[model samples]
Target: MPAGSSTGSLLQTLFALILVLAVLGALAWFLKRYGPKVGGGNANVRVVGSLNLGGRERIVVVEVGNEWIVVGASPGRINALATMPRQDAQHGDHGGTNAALAPHSPAAHSFADWLKQTIDKRK
Candidate 1:
Protein backbone atom coordinates (compact mmCIF):
# COMPACT_ATOMS: atom_id res chain seq x y z
CA MET A 1 0.00 0.00 0.00
CA PRO A 2 1.09 3.57 -0.66
CA ALA A 3 2.41 5.54 2.35
CA GLY A 4 -0.46 8.03 2.23
CA SER A 5 -3.08 5.26 2.00
CA SER A 6 -1.53 3.46 4.99
CA THR A 7 -1.62 6.69 7.06
CA GLY A 8 -5.22 7.33 6.08
CA SER A 9 -6.18 3.78 7.11
CA LEU A 10 -4.42 4.21 10.44
CA LEU A 11 -6.29 7.46 11.14
CA GLN A 12 -9.59 5.81 10.28
CA THR A 13 -8.86 2.91 12.64
CA LEU A 14 -7.93 5.32 15.45
CA PHE A 15 -11.12 7.29 14.93
CA ALA A 16 -13.20 4.15 15.04
CA LEU A 17 -11.57 3.06 18.31
CA ILE A 18 -12.15 6.48 19.87
CA LEU A 19 -15.79 6.45 18.84
CA VAL A 20 -16.32 2.97 20.26
CA LEU A 21 -14.75 3.97 23.59
CA ALA A 22 -16.89 7.09 23.80
CA VAL A 23 -20.02 5.09 23.12
CA LEU A 24 -19.06 2.54 25.77
CA GLY A 25 -18.39 5.22 28.37
CA ALA A 26 -21.73 6.83 27.70
CA LEU A 27 -23.46 3.47 28.00
CA ALA A 28 -21.78 2.81 31.38
CA TRP A 29 -22.85 6.18 32.72
CA PHE A 30 -26.39 5.71 31.52
CA LEU A 31 -26.61 2.31 33.18
CA LYS A 32 -25.18 3.57 36.45
CA ARG A 33 -27.67 6.39 36.61
CA TYR A 34 -30.92 4.98 35.24
CA GLY A 35 -30.45 1.26 35.06
CA PRO A 36 -31.82 0.73 38.55
CA LYS A 37 -35.02 2.49 37.60
CA VAL A 38 -35.56 0.42 34.51
CA GLY A 39 -37.49 -2.04 36.63
CA GLY A 40 -39.16 0.82 38.53
CA GLY A 41 -42.78 -0.05 39.29
CA ASN A 42 -42.84 -3.61 38.01
CA ALA A 43 -39.91 -4.79 40.05
CA ASN A 44 -40.63 -6.64 43.25
CA VAL A 45 -37.24 -5.99 44.86
CA ARG A 46 -36.45 -2.47 45.98
CA VAL A 47 -33.96 -0.84 48.32
CA VAL A 48 -36.06 0.42 51.17
CA GLY A 49 -33.15 1.71 53.28
CA SER A 50 -29.42 1.59 53.91
CA LEU A 51 -27.05 2.51 56.73
CA ASN A 52 -23.31 2.79 56.55
CA LEU A 53 -21.62 1.20 59.55
CA GLY A 54 -18.08 2.00 58.41
CA GLY A 55 -15.93 2.61 55.38
CA ARG A 56 -17.07 -0.47 53.50
CA GLU A 57 -19.71 -2.00 55.73
CA ARG A 58 -23.42 -1.27 55.52
CA ILE A 59 -26.80 -2.62 56.44
CA VAL A 60 -29.34 -2.47 53.67
CA VAL A 61 -33.05 -3.12 53.86
CA VAL A 62 -34.65 -4.38 50.70
CA GLU A 63 -38.26 -5.11 49.96
CA VAL A 64 -38.80 -8.16 47.83
CA GLY A 65 -42.27 -9.35 46.85
CA ASN A 66 -44.34 -8.97 50.00
CA GLU A 67 -41.43 -9.34 52.40
CA TRP A 68 -38.77 -7.00 53.71
CA ILE A 69 -35.23 -8.24 54.23
CA VAL A 70 -32.31 -6.83 56.14
CA VAL A 71 -28.98 -7.41 54.47
CA GLY A 72 -25.47 -6.93 55.74
CA ALA A 73 -23.29 -5.69 52.92
CA SER A 74 -19.54 -5.17 52.78
CA PRO A 75 -16.97 -4.71 50.09
CA GLY A 76 -16.61 -8.45 49.79
CA ARG A 77 -19.95 -10.08 50.51
CA ILE A 78 -23.63 -9.64 51.33
CA ASN A 79 -25.57 -11.58 53.94
CA ALA A 80 -29.19 -11.62 54.92
CA LEU A 81 -29.49 -10.40 58.49
CA ALA A 82 -33.22 -10.77 58.82
CA THR A 83 -36.50 -10.95 56.98
CA MET A 84 -40.03 -9.85 57.84
CA PRO A 85 -43.38 -9.08 56.37
CA ARG A 86 -43.66 -5.75 54.57
CA GLN A 87 -45.11 -3.00 56.69
CA ASP A 88 -47.64 -0.54 55.34
CA ALA A 89 -46.38 3.02 55.60
CA GLN A 90 -49.27 4.95 54.10
CA HIS A 91 -51.73 3.65 56.66
CA GLY A 92 -49.81 5.28 59.56
CA ASP A 93 -47.53 2.36 60.23
CA HIS A 94 -44.39 3.75 61.88
CA GLY A 95 -42.23 1.98 59.35
CA GLY A 96 -41.93 4.78 56.85
CA THR A 97 -40.24 4.38 53.51
CA ASN A 98 -36.52 4.67 52.71
CA ALA A 99 -34.20 5.59 55.61
CA ALA A 100 -37.23 5.91 57.83
CA LEU A 101 -37.37 2.13 57.87
CA ALA A 102 -34.65 2.35 60.49
CA PRO A 103 -35.10 4.61 63.46
CA HIS A 104 -32.19 6.77 64.59
CA SER A 105 -32.53 6.03 68.26
CA PRO A 106 -31.78 2.72 69.97
CA ALA A 107 -35.32 1.77 69.17
CA ALA A 108 -37.02 -1.58 68.64
CA HIS A 109 -36.31 -1.72 64.91
CA SER A 110 -32.67 -0.77 65.07
CA PHE A 111 -30.37 -3.41 63.60
CA ALA A 112 -28.39 -4.07 66.78
CA ASP A 113 -31.46 -4.10 68.93
CA TRP A 114 -33.31 -6.29 66.50
CA LEU A 115 -30.42 -8.69 66.28
CA LYS A 116 -30.27 -8.91 70.07
CA GLN A 117 -33.95 -9.64 70.23
CA THR A 118 -33.70 -12.29 67.55
CA ILE A 119 -30.81 -14.00 69.34
CA ASP A 120 -32.68 -13.90 72.60
CA LYS A 121 -35.68 -15.44 70.96
CA ARG A 122 -33.66 -18.39 69.66
CA LYS A 123 -32.54 -19.25 73.18
Candidate 2:
Protein backbone atom coordinates (compact mmCIF):
# COMPACT_ATOMS: atom_id res chain seq x y z
CA MET A 1 0.00 0.00 0.00
CA PRO A 2 1.30 3.51 -0.92
CA ALA A 3 1.37 5.63 2.24
CA GLY A 4 1.22 9.04 0.47
CA SER A 5 -1.74 8.13 -1.78
CA SER A 6 -3.66 6.49 1.06
CA THR A 7 -3.14 9.54 3.33
CA GLY A 8 -4.28 11.95 0.61
CA SER A 9 -7.38 9.84 -0.13
CA LEU A 10 -8.29 9.65 3.55
CA LEU A 11 -8.01 13.43 3.89
CA GLN A 12 -10.19 13.98 0.82
CA THR A 13 -12.89 11.63 2.14
CA LEU A 14 -12.85 13.35 5.52
CA PHE A 15 -13.26 16.77 3.88
CA ALA A 16 -16.19 15.54 1.79
CA LEU A 17 -17.91 14.07 4.83
CA ILE A 18 -17.45 17.30 6.76
CA LEU A 19 -18.92 19.33 3.92
CA VAL A 20 -22.01 17.12 3.71
CA LEU A 21 -22.56 17.23 7.45
CA ALA A 22 -22.21 20.99 7.55
CA VAL A 23 -24.76 21.45 4.76
CA LEU A 24 -27.27 19.15 6.45
CA GLY A 25 -26.78 20.83 9.82
CA ALA A 26 -27.39 24.25 8.34
CA LEU A 27 -30.56 23.12 6.57
CA ALA A 28 -31.92 21.54 9.75
CA TRP A 29 -31.23 24.67 11.72
CA PHE A 30 -32.94 26.84 9.13
CA LEU A 31 -36.03 24.65 9.08
CA LYS A 32 -36.31 24.67 12.83
CA ARG A 33 -35.77 28.37 13.22
CA TYR A 34 -37.55 29.93 10.22
CA GLY A 35 -39.84 27.30 8.81
CA PRO A 36 -43.34 28.65 8.30
CA LYS A 37 -46.02 27.73 10.81
CA VAL A 38 -49.18 25.90 9.85
CA GLY A 39 -52.66 25.45 11.31
CA GLY A 40 -52.68 26.36 15.00
CA GLY A 41 -49.18 25.08 15.45
CA ASN A 42 -45.94 27.04 15.76
CA ALA A 43 -44.46 28.51 12.63
CA ASN A 44 -42.44 31.41 11.34
CA VAL A 45 -45.51 32.64 9.45
CA ARG A 46 -49.25 32.34 9.97
CA VAL A 47 -52.04 32.26 7.41
CA VAL A 48 -55.03 34.23 8.63
CA GLY A 49 -57.05 34.53 5.45
CA SER A 50 -57.05 33.91 1.72
CA LEU A 51 -57.70 36.19 -1.24
CA ASN A 52 -57.56 35.80 -4.96
CA LEU A 53 -55.45 38.66 -6.21
CA GLY A 54 -56.55 37.50 -9.64
CA GLY A 55 -57.14 34.31 -11.56
CA ARG A 56 -54.47 31.82 -10.43
CA GLU A 57 -53.17 34.62 -8.25
CA ARG A 58 -54.50 33.30 -4.98
CA ILE A 59 -52.61 34.73 -2.07
CA VAL A 60 -52.81 33.49 1.50
CA VAL A 61 -53.58 36.39 3.77
CA VAL A 62 -50.73 36.72 6.26
CA GLU A 63 -50.20 40.21 7.63
CA VAL A 64 -52.73 43.02 7.50
CA GLY A 65 -53.89 46.30 9.14
CA ASN A 66 -50.59 48.14 9.45
CA GLU A 67 -49.39 46.75 6.14
CA TRP A 68 -51.70 44.39 4.43
CA ILE A 69 -49.76 41.47 2.93
CA VAL A 70 -50.59 38.37 0.99
CA VAL A 71 -48.27 35.46 1.45
CA GLY A 72 -48.82 32.14 -0.23
CA ALA A 73 -47.22 29.24 -2.04
CA SER A 74 -47.43 29.37 -5.81
CA PRO A 75 -46.00 26.69 -8.07
CA GLY A 76 -44.13 25.48 -5.03
CA ARG A 77 -42.82 28.98 -4.45
CA ILE A 78 -43.25 30.75 -1.12
CA ASN A 79 -43.94 34.43 -1.66
CA ALA A 80 -44.56 37.32 0.74
CA LEU A 81 -45.98 40.42 -0.88
CA ALA A 82 -47.34 43.71 0.33
CA THR A 83 -51.03 44.11 -0.46
CA MET A 84 -51.14 47.88 -0.30
CA PRO A 85 -52.37 50.18 -3.05
CA ARG A 86 -49.37 52.46 -2.95
CA GLN A 87 -46.47 50.06 -3.13
CA ASP A 88 -43.90 52.82 -2.58
CA ALA A 89 -45.53 53.98 0.63
CA GLN A 90 -43.66 54.30 3.90
CA HIS A 91 -45.60 51.68 5.81
CA GLY A 92 -45.16 48.80 3.39
CA ASP A 93 -43.62 45.85 5.10
CA HIS A 94 -45.11 46.71 8.51
CA GLY A 95 -42.44 44.54 10.07
CA GLY A 96 -39.96 47.32 10.64
CA THR A 97 -37.99 50.01 8.90
CA ASN A 98 -35.73 48.61 6.22
CA ALA A 99 -34.41 51.49 4.21
CA ALA A 100 -31.70 49.21 2.97
CA LEU A 101 -34.05 46.48 1.85
CA ALA A 102 -33.19 45.15 -1.60
CA PRO A 103 -33.58 42.04 -3.62
CA HIS A 104 -31.19 39.34 -2.49
CA SER A 105 -30.01 37.11 -5.32
CA PRO A 106 -33.05 38.09 -7.42
CA ALA A 107 -35.29 36.59 -4.76
CA ALA A 108 -34.58 32.99 -3.92
CA HIS A 109 -36.86 30.40 -5.51
CA SER A 110 -38.12 27.01 -4.51
CA PHE A 111 -36.14 23.80 -4.98
CA ALA A 112 -38.25 23.00 -8.01
CA ASP A 113 -37.51 26.34 -9.63
CA TRP A 114 -33.84 25.93 -8.95
CA LEU A 115 -33.87 22.51 -10.54
CA LYS A 116 -35.75 23.80 -13.54
CA GLN A 117 -33.39 26.72 -13.96
CA THR A 118 -30.34 24.49 -13.72
CA ILE A 119 -31.67 22.16 -16.38
CA ASP A 120 -32.74 25.03 -18.65
CA LYS A 121 -29.36 26.67 -18.37
CA ARG A 122 -27.64 23.43 -19.33
CA LYS A 123 -29.69 23.17 -22.50
Candidate 3:
Protein backbone atom coordinates (compact mmCIF):
# COMPACT_ATOMS: atom_id res chain seq x y z
CA MET A 1 0.00 0.00 0.00
CA PRO A 2 1.11 3.60 -0.51
CA ALA A 3 2.55 5.41 2.58
CA GLY A 4 -0.23 8.08 2.42
CA SER A 5 -2.94 5.41 2.29
CA SER A 6 -1.54 3.61 5.34
CA THR A 7 -1.35 6.86 7.32
CA GLY A 8 -4.93 7.72 6.36
CA SER A 9 -6.12 4.29 7.40
CA LEU A 10 -4.31 4.56 10.77
CA LEU A 11 -5.96 7.93 11.48
CA GLN A 12 -9.37 6.56 10.62
CA THR A 13 -8.88 3.65 13.00
CA LEU A 14 -7.78 6.01 15.76
CA PHE A 15 -10.86 8.18 15.21
CA ALA A 16 -13.08 5.13 15.43
CA LEU A 17 -11.52 4.03 18.71
CA ILE A 18 -11.94 7.49 20.22
CA LEU A 19 -15.59 7.60 19.18
CA VAL A 20 -16.27 4.23 20.68
CA LEU A 21 -14.64 5.23 23.99
CA ALA A 22 -16.66 8.43 24.18
CA VAL A 23 -19.90 6.58 23.63
CA LEU A 24 -18.99 4.03 26.25
CA GLY A 25 -18.07 6.73 28.77
CA ALA A 26 -21.39 8.50 28.31
CA LEU A 27 -23.27 5.25 28.80
CA ALA A 28 -21.36 4.51 31.97
CA TRP A 29 -22.13 7.94 33.34
CA PHE A 30 -25.82 7.58 32.62
CA LEU A 31 -25.94 4.24 34.33
CA LYS A 32 -23.84 5.29 37.33
CA ARG A 33 -26.30 8.13 37.92
CA TYR A 34 -29.23 5.76 37.59
CA GLY A 35 -28.41 2.08 38.15
CA PRO A 36 -29.56 1.37 41.72
CA LYS A 37 -33.09 2.37 40.75
CA VAL A 38 -33.66 -1.13 39.49
CA GLY A 39 -31.72 -2.97 42.19
CA GLY A 40 -34.37 -3.19 44.92
CA GLY A 41 -36.40 -6.40 44.80
CA ASN A 42 -35.88 -8.34 48.04
CA ALA A 43 -38.94 -8.32 50.35
CA ASN A 44 -36.86 -7.46 53.41
CA VAL A 45 -35.83 -4.17 51.92
CA ARG A 46 -37.63 -1.06 53.24
CA VAL A 47 -38.66 1.93 51.16
CA VAL A 48 -39.08 5.38 52.68
CA GLY A 49 -40.16 7.42 49.68
CA SER A 50 -39.28 8.51 46.14
CA LEU A 51 -38.06 11.64 44.37
CA ASN A 52 -38.71 13.17 40.96
CA LEU A 53 -35.67 14.33 39.08
CA GLY A 54 -36.30 16.13 35.81
CA GLY A 55 -39.25 13.95 34.76
CA ARG A 56 -38.33 10.51 36.07
CA GLU A 57 -38.62 9.30 39.62
CA ARG A 58 -36.74 6.26 40.82
CA ILE A 59 -38.30 3.91 43.34
CA VAL A 60 -36.14 3.69 46.44
CA VAL A 61 -35.63 0.31 48.09
CA VAL A 62 -33.69 -0.73 51.16
CA GLU A 63 -32.57 -4.19 52.20
CA VAL A 64 -33.26 -5.10 55.82
CA GLY A 65 -33.48 -8.61 57.17
CA ASN A 66 -31.66 -11.79 58.12
CA GLU A 67 -28.41 -10.14 59.04
CA TRP A 68 -28.72 -6.56 57.81
CA ILE A 69 -31.40 -3.89 57.57
CA VAL A 70 -31.03 -0.77 55.46
CA VAL A 71 -32.96 2.41 56.21
CA GLY A 72 -33.23 4.78 53.32
CA ALA A 73 -35.87 6.87 51.61
CA SER A 74 -36.97 5.44 48.27
CA PRO A 75 -36.57 7.19 44.89
CA GLY A 76 -33.19 8.62 45.96
CA ARG A 77 -34.72 11.26 48.18
CA ILE A 78 -32.28 10.78 51.06
CA ASN A 79 -28.72 9.76 51.63
CA ALA A 80 -27.74 7.37 54.39
CA LEU A 81 -26.39 9.18 57.43
CA ALA A 82 -25.91 6.44 59.98
CA THR A 83 -26.47 2.70 60.09
CA MET A 84 -26.64 0.39 63.10
CA PRO A 85 -25.97 -3.29 63.07
CA ARG A 86 -28.40 -5.51 64.93
CA GLN A 87 -28.44 -9.10 66.05
CA ASP A 88 -29.06 -11.65 63.36
CA ALA A 89 -32.72 -12.55 63.07
CA GLN A 90 -33.51 -15.74 64.95
CA HIS A 91 -36.20 -18.09 63.64
CA GLY A 92 -38.64 -16.46 66.08
CA ASP A 93 -37.25 -12.96 65.74
CA HIS A 94 -40.59 -11.23 65.25
CA GLY A 95 -41.72 -12.68 68.58
CA GLY A 96 -38.43 -12.29 70.36
CA THR A 97 -36.82 -9.02 71.53
CA ASN A 98 -38.66 -6.74 69.14
CA ALA A 99 -42.01 -8.40 68.78
CA ALA A 100 -44.04 -5.61 67.22
CA LEU A 101 -45.90 -8.00 64.91
CA ALA A 102 -47.10 -10.46 67.58
CA PRO A 103 -50.54 -10.66 69.16
CA HIS A 104 -48.94 -10.73 72.62
CA SER A 105 -46.42 -8.18 71.47
CA PRO A 106 -44.24 -5.95 73.57
CA ALA A 107 -44.15 -2.19 73.24
CA ALA A 108 -43.90 -0.88 69.69
CA HIS A 109 -40.83 1.24 70.34
CA SER A 110 -39.18 -1.27 72.62
CA PHE A 111 -35.95 -1.05 70.71
CA ALA A 112 -35.94 2.73 70.51
CA ASP A 113 -36.84 3.05 74.15
CA TRP A 114 -34.01 0.74 75.07
CA LEU A 115 -31.53 3.51 74.60
CA LYS A 116 -33.36 5.69 77.10
CA GLN A 117 -33.84 2.78 79.49
CA THR A 118 -30.16 1.97 79.20
CA ILE A 119 -29.14 5.31 80.62
CA ASP A 120 -31.77 5.19 83.34
CA LYS A 121 -31.02 1.59 84.19
CA ARG A 122 -27.37 2.57 84.48
CA LYS A 123 -28.34 5.22 87.03
Candidate 4:
Protein backbone atom coordinates (compact mmCIF):
# COMPACT_ATOMS: atom_id res chain seq x y z
CA MET A 1 0.00 0.00 0.00
CA PRO A 2 1.24 3.48 -0.86
CA ALA A 3 2.01 5.86 2.05
CA GLY A 4 0.00 8.61 0.42
CA SER A 5 -3.03 6.30 0.02
CA SER A 6 -2.88 5.27 3.73
CA THR A 7 -2.78 8.94 4.83
CA GLY A 8 -5.76 9.73 2.59
CA SER A 9 -7.72 6.82 4.07
CA LEU A 10 -6.94 7.99 7.63
CA LEU A 11 -8.12 11.51 6.82
CA GLN A 12 -11.34 10.17 5.29
CA THR A 13 -12.06 8.09 8.42
CA LEU A 14 -11.49 11.08 10.68
CA PHE A 15 -13.72 13.26 8.55
CA ALA A 16 -16.51 10.68 8.72
CA LEU A 17 -16.22 10.43 12.50
CA ILE A 18 -16.32 14.21 12.90
CA LEU A 19 -19.37 14.46 10.64
CA VAL A 20 -21.21 11.84 12.68
CA LEU A 21 -20.40 13.61 15.95
CA ALA A 22 -21.55 16.94 14.62
CA VAL A 23 -24.83 15.46 13.44
CA LEU A 24 -25.40 13.84 16.82
CA GLY A 25 -24.66 17.09 18.65
CA ALA A 26 -27.08 19.02 16.47
CA LEU A 27 -29.80 16.44 17.02
CA ALA A 28 -29.32 16.59 20.78
CA TRP A 29 -29.52 20.37 20.76
CA PHE A 30 -32.68 20.33 18.66
CA LEU A 31 -34.34 17.78 20.94
CA LYS A 32 -33.41 19.67 24.08
CA ARG A 33 -34.91 22.85 22.65
CA TYR A 34 -38.02 21.40 20.94
CA GLY A 35 -38.81 18.00 22.43
CA PRO A 36 -42.18 17.00 23.87
CA LYS A 37 -42.83 18.31 27.40
CA VAL A 38 -42.44 16.15 30.50
CA GLY A 39 -46.10 15.56 31.44
CA GLY A 40 -47.76 16.95 28.33
CA GLY A 41 -48.83 20.25 26.83
CA ASN A 42 -52.50 19.76 27.59
CA ALA A 43 -53.88 22.45 29.87
CA ASN A 44 -57.07 20.66 30.90
CA VAL A 45 -55.46 17.66 32.62
CA ARG A 46 -52.94 17.75 35.43
CA VAL A 47 -51.72 15.38 38.10
CA VAL A 48 -52.35 16.96 41.47
CA GLY A 49 -50.97 14.24 43.74
CA SER A 50 -49.98 10.61 43.99
CA LEU A 51 -49.49 8.05 46.78
CA ASN A 52 -47.79 4.72 46.39
CA LEU A 53 -49.97 1.97 47.81
CA GLY A 54 -47.60 -0.93 47.15
CA GLY A 55 -44.90 -2.01 44.73
CA ARG A 56 -47.14 -1.74 41.71
CA GLU A 57 -50.17 0.10 43.04
CA ARG A 58 -50.68 3.83 43.42
CA ILE A 59 -53.44 6.32 44.07
CA VAL A 60 -53.28 9.36 41.79
CA VAL A 61 -55.28 12.53 41.95
CA VAL A 62 -55.82 14.17 38.56
CA GLU A 63 -57.34 17.52 37.90
CA VAL A 64 -59.43 17.76 34.76
CA GLY A 65 -61.35 20.87 33.85
CA ASN A 66 -63.23 21.96 36.98
CA GLU A 67 -62.99 18.70 38.94
CA TRP A 68 -60.41 16.49 40.52
CA ILE A 69 -60.59 12.72 39.97
CA VAL A 70 -59.04 10.15 42.23
CA VAL A 71 -57.63 7.18 40.34
CA GLY A 72 -56.24 3.85 41.43
CA ALA A 73 -53.56 2.49 39.13
CA SER A 74 -51.88 -0.90 39.21
CA PRO A 75 -50.12 -2.70 36.41
CA GLY A 76 -52.68 -3.13 33.65
CA ARG A 77 -55.73 -1.60 35.30
CA ILE A 78 -56.65 1.99 36.12
CA ASN A 79 -59.88 2.88 37.85
CA ALA A 80 -61.41 6.16 38.89
CA LEU A 81 -62.04 6.08 42.61
CA ALA A 82 -63.80 9.39 43.14
CA THR A 83 -64.31 12.90 41.80
CA MET A 84 -64.53 16.25 43.57
CA PRO A 85 -64.40 19.95 42.86
CA ARG A 86 -61.00 21.39 42.04
CA GLN A 87 -59.14 23.07 44.86
CA ASP A 88 -58.26 26.73 44.75
CA ALA A 89 -54.78 27.35 43.40
CA GLN A 90 -54.68 30.96 44.61
CA HIS A 91 -54.01 29.78 48.18
CA GLY A 92 -50.80 27.93 47.21
CA ASP A 93 -52.63 24.59 46.98
CA HIS A 94 -50.93 23.37 43.85
CA GLY A 95 -48.70 20.45 42.91
CA GLY A 96 -49.54 17.28 44.88
CA THR A 97 -51.73 18.41 47.80
CA ASN A 98 -55.49 18.82 48.06
CA ALA A 99 -56.94 20.50 51.13
CA ALA A 100 -60.33 18.83 50.72
CA LEU A 101 -58.66 15.44 50.75
CA ALA A 102 -56.23 16.16 53.57
CA PRO A 103 -55.90 18.60 56.44
CA HIS A 104 -54.23 21.95 55.82
CA SER A 105 -51.78 22.71 58.62
CA PRO A 106 -48.00 22.70 58.86
CA ALA A 107 -48.14 20.69 62.09
CA ALA A 108 -50.61 18.16 60.73
CA HIS A 109 -49.48 14.74 59.57
CA SER A 110 -48.48 14.35 55.95
CA PHE A 111 -50.90 13.38 53.27
CA ALA A 112 -49.46 9.89 53.20
CA ASP A 113 -50.55 9.41 56.80
CA TRP A 114 -54.10 10.47 56.01
CA LEU A 115 -54.19 8.13 53.01
CA LYS A 116 -52.91 5.20 55.03
CA GLN A 117 -55.55 5.71 57.69
CA THR A 118 -58.29 5.87 55.08
CA ILE A 119 -57.09 2.64 53.48
CA ASP A 120 -56.81 0.84 56.83
CA LYS A 121 -60.44 1.53 57.57
CA ARG A 122 -61.51 -0.16 54.33
CA LYS A 123 -59.79 -3.41 55.21
Residue pairs with backbone atoms closer than 3 Å in model 1 (clashes):
none
Ranking by TM-score: 4, 1, 3, 2
TM per candidate: 0.53, 0.31, 0.34, 0.55
lDDT of 2 by residue, 1-123 (tens): 699999999999999999999999999999878997656654444444464556666656453433435465566676764343212224554322222222332322332343344346568
TM-score of 3: 0.34
Error of 4 at 57 (Å): 1.8
| Model 2: lowest-lDDT 10 consecutive positions | 94-103
Name model 1 segments beyond 4 Å from true. Answer: 1-42, 90-112
In candidate 3, what are the lDDT values of residues 1-123, reduced to their tens digit? 699999999999999999999999999999989777665566766533232334544323233563222233445575452233433344655422452322332334544443344346457
List ranges where model 4 is wrong by over 4 Å. Answer: 1-7, 34-39, 87-123
Cα displacement (Å) at residue 37, model 3? 2.0
What CA RMSD would candidate 2 show? 17.6
lDDT of 1 by residue, 1-123 (tens): 699999999999999999999999999999988787654666788887677889999988788997889899998899998787776664454453322233432336444566566567678
lDDT (0 to 1) per candidate: 0.73, 0.52, 0.48, 0.75
By lDDT, rank the candidates, best first: 4, 1, 2, 3
Comparison by lDDT, 2 against 4, better one? 4
Whichever of 1 and 4 has more TM-score, that candidate is 4
Candidate 4: 10-residue stretch with minimal lDDT: 101-110
Residue 86 accuracy (lDDT) in model 1? 73
Error of 1 at 56 (Å): 0.9
